[model samples]
Target: MLVTLEGLDGSGKTTVWERLRSDDMVPDETVFTREPTDTWYGDAVQRSIDDDDADSLAELFLYTADHAAHLSNTVRPALEENRLVVSDRYSDSRYAYQGATLADSEMLDDPLSYVREVHAPWTRPPDRTVYLDLDPETAAKRSGATNKFETADYLATVRDNYERLIEADPERFVRVDATADPDTVYERVRDAIV
Candidate 1:
């Protein structure tokens, strides 16, 4: 089974993934991974992220490349072995964050749709997704507004894209409020997973 944890940068999905790694509740052989993976492709994506003036289309493709590498190198092999796969972020991150980034450009009529279409052909769909929900202001604060994507205004647009994704595939996603205390949020996420 493939499960993905998704939300804004500071929504605690990464924290939850870390906790899950040490928890006895989750399967011992479960594979936990993330995107922009710790690879050369991801390195390029990180570089683009730090460059505020980076071309939106270029950044999107960089992220897409990292995700593709993540699948081929890690996610696919684990799933082929029938191991439980839990990823901190997946293609949905591209659909949300990159879609928001490209919103102002005249490149595509619907950025979110365009992002999804780009991934639709080869991406492996998660069996379930735990979406940690938080307001944009709070998310920005928690994330420290460290990067262009962490800004409240940009996060708000990203949040909207997430909502659209959840609406389109309600059955695959479970929403967990991220405004609660860390323990509470983590518990809810773990519960949603197992």
Candidate 2:
């Protein structure tokens, strides 16, 4: 099974992933990856973040490249071996953040459709997508001002997009309230998968 955690910055995805790994709730054979993964492409994404670059399109392409490399080198092989794969973030984030950035740009008419047509075909969707829901204010407080993309306003829009994504595909997506305790959220995730 391939499980992915999706949420706004500071929604506790990294914490949850670490907890799951430490607890061995994530299978030993399971491979864990995150977007802006530790690759050259990922490094570029990180640089973009650090520089506070407004080139949303460049960031989007970097993320796409990272996803493609991650899938080809890691996720797909693990799946082929029948090992569960858990990812902290995936393609959905691109559709949310990049799409939001491109909302008013005449170039991005239908961001989802564009992503689906251009990038979706190259990647695999997760078996289950877990969205850790939290309010923008709370998310910002938790996240701090580390990344350029972690703004409260942007996260609010990302959260809304996540909700819409979930609503469109209820069967594959699970929304969990991250405002609760970590254990509570972990239990919910465990229950959902098992």
Candidate 3:
């Protein structure tokens, strides 16, 4: 099972993911990992985020490269050995965040289409996706000014993109109200898992 957790920053993805990890909630063969891996690909994305002049399209490409390395070097090997892979974030984050960032750009005819195209070969359909849904205001309060995309307006747009993704394929996503307490949210997350 390739279970990817998706949501805005400070949406309790880390908290819930930790619970899912330490609690031994998944099968015994579970392996936990995340994108923007610890490789140079990961470093490049991190650096890009801190770069004041980072282009939206360039940032998107950086993420795509990270995903490619993550799959080839980490995820696929674990899955090949029959381990259930639970990721902190996945391609959905790109579609939600970068796609929203590029939506207004005249550079691309269609940002989402271009993003989907860039990630087409490496995109792995999640067996299930848990989206910890929290409004931008609350999320901002939890994590203040983390990056360029941390603004309420931008996060709201990202949230909308996530909603659209879920709507497009309802079975692929399970929405969890992240405003609830961690324990309560963890319960919902476990229930949502296939």
- Provide the overall lDDT of each model, using Cα atoms, as 2-decimal numbers: 0.93, 0.82, 0.87
Give the lDDT of residue 11 in candidate 1.
93
User: For each candidate, what TM-score against the reference?
Assistant: 0.98, 0.94, 0.95
Residue-wise C-alpha lDDT for candidate 2, range 112-150, written one tens digit per residue: 657657775567888999988999888988999588777
Candidate 1 lDDT, 1-194, residue by residue in tens: 99999999899998899999999999999999998898899899999989989999999999999999999999999999999999999999999998999999886899999999999999999999999999999999999988888989999999999999999999999999998899999899888888
Best by TM-score: 1
In order of listing, the candidates' clash counts read: 0, 0, 0
Better lDDT candidate (2, 3) = 3
What is the overall TM-score of model 1 with all chains considered together?
A: 0.98
Candidate 2 lDDT score at position 96: 77
* True-structure lDDT of candidate 1: 0.93
Whole-model lDDT for model 3 versus the true structure?
0.87
What's the distance in Å from true for residue 155, model 3? 0.2
Off by over 4 Å in 3: none
In candidate 1, how many Å is residue 22 off?
Answer: 0.3
Can you rank all candidates by TM-score, best first? 1, 3, 2
* Per-residue error (Å), model 2, residue 194: 3.7
Identify the runs in model 1 with alpha carbons over 4 angstroms from their true place: none
Ranking by lDDT: 1, 3, 2
